[model samples]
Target: MMEREARRTPPELQELTEQLSLRWFGRPFIHEAVYNPRLRTTGGRYMLRDHSIQVNPAVEMMYGEEELIGVLKHELCHYHLHLEGRGYKHGDSDFRELLRKTGSPRFCKPLQAEQQRTVRHYRCADCGRQYERRRRVDTSRYRCGKCRGKLQEVQ
Candidate 1:
């Protein structure tokens, strides 16, 4: 993945933020916007401490720039409204309305590369054979591929 500075919203995010801010909030985003690698399990977040937006780098690395722009818009909604002293929280009415008005997505998909994606573990019910797979195996029909015994999950 690119460094967080390189990931700074990109040229597309910059343009999208400029347009969205003008259309939805009647202002411009003047602060630095960049991805923070430490953020896990979230699409984006606005830093109240600096008024900067920290987007999860996983978004671009996994979903591409188009989806990342949507997240940018979402964060910008918080940025603009907060700077103006309007209700800017996720549960606030103003925030919700601004999100809808800007056509921003509420959630983003988890990047498969971000963590362990799948695990299938089983053990034999009959002979105590254990099995582990990335894909699930049929418990009713398929037995331990090695011992031909019933399989159960071990871990």
Candidate 2:
């Protein structure tokens, strides 16, 4: 389940789960759902080892609850289908069908709030071409690929 660390209460989670389950699966989710802080890169994951659902808190923190709910539904597709002995794996027919049937999101999209933010800027020493990056580049190790020239930081 993916609601234990959730900012939402048990009752809220239960309600949310029910609503999503019904809206997507047309069936009730009878198990626990929880928020997992250790998740990374991925939006959510199903514990094949334990049958519990682990949702990335970053899904909500970065993307918001709507996307978080989508992540839940995506995981639920695995949860309910697995519990019912249906295709739970992503490549399985049942899983694919369920995704379409429930309108659950297939991919957990990242938050775009900072899409325009720039952290590092670079200039080509030879051509003065400019490049922007979100991470710092090692000037000693990196060279401008376009002009095969040295790159310098511009503020």
Top lDDT: which candidate number? 2
Task: Tell me the TM-score of model 1.
Answer: 0.63
Tens-place lDDT per residue, model 2, 1-155, is 13233366546765787788888777887766776666656887888877766666666766567887888889999989888998899999999998897778888885343344667889999999999888899989999988789999998
Displacement of residue 135 (Cα, Å) in model 1 is 22
Off by over 4 Å in 2: 1-7, 111-155
RMSD for all candidates, in order, please.
7.9, 5.5
lDDT of each: 0.77, 0.78
Top model by TM-score, which number?
1
Candidate 1 C-alpha lDDT tens digits along 1-155? 33233344456556666776777667888886766778887888999989988777778776676878788888988998999999999899999998898888777776555466587889887777666688877788787766688776676
Residue 147 C-alpha lDDT in model 2: 77
